[model samples]
Target: MTVTRFAPSPNGPLHLGHAWSAIVGHDRAKADGGEFLLRIEDIDGARSRADLADEFRRDLEWLRLDYREVAPQSQRVATYRDAADSLRAMGLLYPCRCTRAEIAAAATRMGPDGPVYPQTCLHRPIAPGPGVVWRLDVEQAADLCGQLTWTDERRGEQVARPELFGDVVLWRKDAPASYHLAATIDDAADGITCVTRGLDLFHATHIHRLLQALLGIEPPVWHHHALLVEADGRKLAKRRDAPALAERRLAGEDGRSVAAELRHGLLDTGISFADTLLLDA
Candidate 1:
């Protein structure tokens, strides 16, 4: 049976972009006679709020999107820790103590996630101390796993090249696990058959495919859909002042109608669907 999930962080309210992603995952699961699941990605320390978490549930209910809610990432610290320990035992994990500014200054090239880490701390014999992030050695891991490939419903077959991301972080300095670690671990644990999200994270799948191989977790097929953007071409992001769905709902917009419009790629706000499909192609 196919299983799909909509995992949203509760640090901010859901926006139209989030709505589109969730609705697509829900519809895909329904079409396949499968189950849809909701996962609260609230693992960020201190930044994630219980109030915001409640709001996330309320917003989903307001849209009438049904799903089985899984335990939030906050409750799964031990699982991530164990996974990190396993990787460390294999010598594929390293301690990185570089600050953001240091990384920015050192990186000569850029990847999808800002400046690609230069792996400055990869060989540092420094003991795990304060502000240390756990990084996975992508080159060593790929060598161990040999060539890897993953499939996307929209883009077809893909050869995984995690090296583009350099040695990515598995456990963050501030959080129990990075998004890549937590999402990959939880998806496997929840038996998710398909991973659905926006195309901005399309490159992230390469790193995820590597994690699945390294962790011995079953990989899910991916769906990297287009992103919702404004007329000026700015992608919708809370930090970028994207309108929150709750704000619209409070202003008397019908949640179900909004969801329907999002599902059909229709929005009253003149939000353009940025075609990331060609890039994936």
Candidate 2:
């Protein structure tokens, strides 16, 4: 059976964009007789909160977008560590000690996207810096998987150029796995044969696909759906101006109304969303 998940960060309340992503993820998997999992990606300790996590679960369940299993990235530290160690053993991983200022200076000298590390620290001592970030060297990655191709159900044939994803970071200096690492690892472990997510991450297909190749895993079939946008035509974000889902729910608006608003908001984006998903809620 196919498996897919709607992973959300608990730093803030779920917004209209999240609702749309949840509905599409759950509905698409169910339609194919697959399992839908709920993953709480709260690895960022500085921003993650128990209260927000509780609201995350509450919000999805309140919308009736149930999942077969639930897991949190915070609880999977060992998994990330093991993966990093394996990459290190393969010599595909590097410890980067560059600070923000150093990077900015390099950028100023080399031009934007400039300085790109110059790979200065690639073979040098990290000099016991404040923090270290683990990066996967892309050239080594490409030698492992030449020319990867990902076909999304909606966007079709997406390709990742080797240069764009070079030296991608997998973990921050503090040992917490970056979003790129945690997400791909969870998807692989959960048997997610089909991955459905928003279009805003549409470019991530290349990064994830590259990571899959480096990790000796097969890329899952992707389905990048239209994103939930605001009236100003901006993509909705939790930290920004998107309407809060919890607030909307508490303000006497039912799930149906929220779903309608989402569908209407995404009308120009060319995706079919059903209001019936809210009927049971």
Candidate 3:
């Protein structure tokens, strides 16, 4: 059976942008007679608000989205650690002690996800410890699994270029697992056949494709739908204080109507669909 998931971090309340993404995944699964899953990405440690997870459920309920809940990332530390250990054993991971400010100051050029890591810690021989992060040796990893590819439902086949991101983090010193490692493992664990998410993360799929190859897992077809953006063209984000869905619910707005509007590419004032191609089609 086809499976798709809406994995949201519980660090903040659900907004309209989040609702659109959830609806896309939920409706897609329903359309295909497949299963829809909801996974809480609460692995950000202290930054993750446990209470917000409950709010997320409430929001989804208000939106009338049906989904099966999966174990949150906090409950899957061992899984991530086991995966990290496997990669380490294969000599594909190394410990990095560089701080964010230090990396920004030292980085000479940028890549898809900001400044490419300069490999300062690649040859440092640093041992895994409390204060160090684990980074994938992207060069070595690509060599091991040469000429990898993944398919996007809309964009067709893509050549995986994991090296573009440099040695990306697999495990963080403050969190149990980085987004790349945890999300990839969770999708495979849940037997997800369709990876549905926003286009902002389109580039991250390159790294995900590489991880799938290294771990010997079957790759899923991707559907990177367009994002909902403000009139200024910036994407709606919690950090930017975007309007929350809870407010609309509290105002007694009809959730189903709102969802229907979103399906037709209509949204509130000052907010619009960034792109309509293949959205709820």
By TM-score, the better pick of 1 and 2 is 1
Error of 2 at 209 (Å): 1.1
Stretches off by above 4 angstroms in model 3 are: 276-281
* All models, RMSD in angstroms: 1.6, 6.3, 2.9
TM-score of 3: 0.96
Model 3 lDDT tens row, 202-273: 889999999999998899999989899999988899999998998899999988888999999888899987
Model 2 / residue 53 / CA error / Å: 1.4
Q: Write the per-residue lDDT of candidate 1 for residues 48-113, one digit (tens) a residue.
A: 888877887778888988899999898888999999999999999999888889999999988777
Query: TM-score for each prediction?
Result: 0.96, 0.85, 0.96
Model 3: lowest-lDDT 10 consecutive positions:
272-281
| TM-score of model 1 vs. true structure | 0.96
- Pick the lDDT winner: 3
Off by over 4 Å in 1: 277-281
The lDDT-based order of candidates, best leading, equals 3, 1, 2
Per-model clash counts, in order, read 0, 1, 0
Residue 196 Cα positional deviation in candidate 1, in Å, after optimal superposition: 0.8
